[model samples]
Target chain A: MNANIPSEVLPILLILIGTIFSLLSAIGLVRLPDVYTRSHAASKSTTLGVLFILVGTFLFFLLEEHYFSIRLFLGIFFVFLTAPVAAHVLVRSAYRSNVALAEESVQDDLKDFIHTDSKKTKDAEVNDTD
Target chain B: MIEIMLICSLIFLTLSIIAIMYRLVKGPSASDRVQALDTLGINIISGVAVFSVLMRSTGFFEVILLIGILSFIGTIAFARYLERGVVIERKHPK
Candidate 1:
């Protein structure tokens, strides 16, 4: 909110926003009771945080150094591409491995689809237990 | 002023990384460790960004990309291993 030295402060402010989100995700990761909840926090919040930091850095370099970085742009793109997929793959494996849900969580929307024996095909079961 | 803020950002990033490490070390399950590693990677990326800004350099840009690639691949490999019991599944020739 300090606006005195107005022009360059925006980049730093954005970086602060990113670091704060990272702090938020770290807290969530530590405090969440279950793996699913922890994955949620780890994936989403930190992705946004990293995005903000990269964008802010790109802006800073552009404004102050007169440099355009293709690499930074690619970093942004790669994080966006991979963060959710990694989290998804990780959580799916967690579920497949029989990790239990937290006691506090009441509703399991995927229960019928994921755990029902009759609903699963023969090959699906093979792949699942393989 | 810019230096002070970037330094502060780095401090916060370091603190976050430490907290994530707690989970990494104490996490009860394999997936928990994977998640922690992913989060740690993201934090390291930002940390590197802030450090580069502090140093007023563009050299670490590739470091950021490298970390991202490595982290993503590591997470996927860990997940596959956890789920399937092997990172690479070999086909049985019929």
Candidate 2:
């Protein structure tokens, strides 16, 4: 109710910073050259952004409304668990499917490993359909 | 004054979503579109959080979790489909 309280100010500050983070992630997504780099921006920055934003809301409700929302806390936990995993899964698929990396990218350590890996799996898939 | 700040944040979040949408539509590869969808889900979650805070209510909490779960599952499924052209993994073909 009272914005003058120092604790109250913290939540709003967090919300604003998170908004900036999300905005930056959006910019990164639009500007990045490859899906991998874009995933980096999307997963890392947006995870931080959403986490901070949710934490701000949780604190706001706890302090101002005298409420403790277990759901909000759980939401925080779920995002922490899932964002990176999803990004990794997507990039893995992209690489295996031969989606080319951005030309300027510096290294290709997974090149040989993925070649052997996908071949075995591709053979198994051929059998599965038969 | 607080309401104004929340509104401004909402505006910024909307802009973020729109920028992402361009990538979703024009992305050269399916993987790019999948990544865009994941980011879009995150933005929606943040937007709902801001709107909930502005409303001064706790009701949007469930929506946040639901979207998170669905986005995660959808991303995983798409990734699997892209990798091996299979999502459910019916058999290993021993």
Candidate 3:
């Protein structure tokens, strides 16, 4: 394929950036102190990492082969939409299951909220019994 | 030059996957393992994309899309199962 300088350079640049982000995310996964923090690293960096790589691939095919792909676009959109929601669900499930926070976690606002809500439900149950 | 860069990047990606696998094996809690698994899925997607580019083929686009869908569904299912003991429920009229 005959290509100009910018056309050739951009995909390489994107791939390098994507690979670095993916590596960093992996390191964060291995080194983070807790599940919550690890989820942060895993979801955010990896999403972006995959995005960059997909974008790079799209551009490579577009320029090198003069062909456009709808699948790549769909993949990009799907990853962007789903990755964060999946992470949120994972963390929320962990919290509801009473996963312990790190020792460095100083405050828990959800604890009081949950306690009061449970008490109010119990009171409602007693009044119904009466 | 480009081929060499792609090769080196592939090596780096493999190492990163190995590092994530370490967490997958060593995670103390179920959520930790799940989180690592989610990250592993994303890593695999990136790896597949890079591999397709390196090989100058577009046949793997469908594979990338399929992995993304399956991983998201798996993460949601695991999260629901963890939040409650059941992933699906039947409702009865009162």
Question: What is candidate 3's CA lDDT for residue A66?
Answer: 90
Tens-place lDDT digits, model 2, residues B1-94: 7889999999999999999999999999999999999999999999999999999878899999999999999999999999978897754445
Model 1, residue pairs in steric clash: none
Clashes of 3: 0
Cα misplacement distance, residue B86 of candidate 3 (Å):
0.6
Interface RMSD measured for model 1: 0.6
Each candidate's DockQ: 0.92, 0.90, 0.86
Q: Number of the top candidate by lDDT?
A: 2
- How much does each candidate deviate at the interface, measured as C-alpha RMSD after superposition? 0.6, 0.5, 0.6
Task: Report model 2's TM-score to 2 decimal places.
Answer: 0.93
Clashing pairs in 3: none
Tens-digit per-residue lDDT, B1-94, candidate 1: 6788888889889999999999999999888988899899889999999999899899999999999999999999999999878998876634
**Local accuracy by lDDT, each model:** 0.90, 0.92, 0.90
Better TM-score candidate (2, 3): 2
Predictions ranked by TM-score, top down? 2, 3, 1
In model 2, state the lDDT of residue B54. 95
- The residue-by-residue lDDT of candidate 2 on A1-130, one tens digit each, is 6655776777888899999999999999999999878888988999999998999999888887789999999999999999999999999899989998899999999999989977888797789787
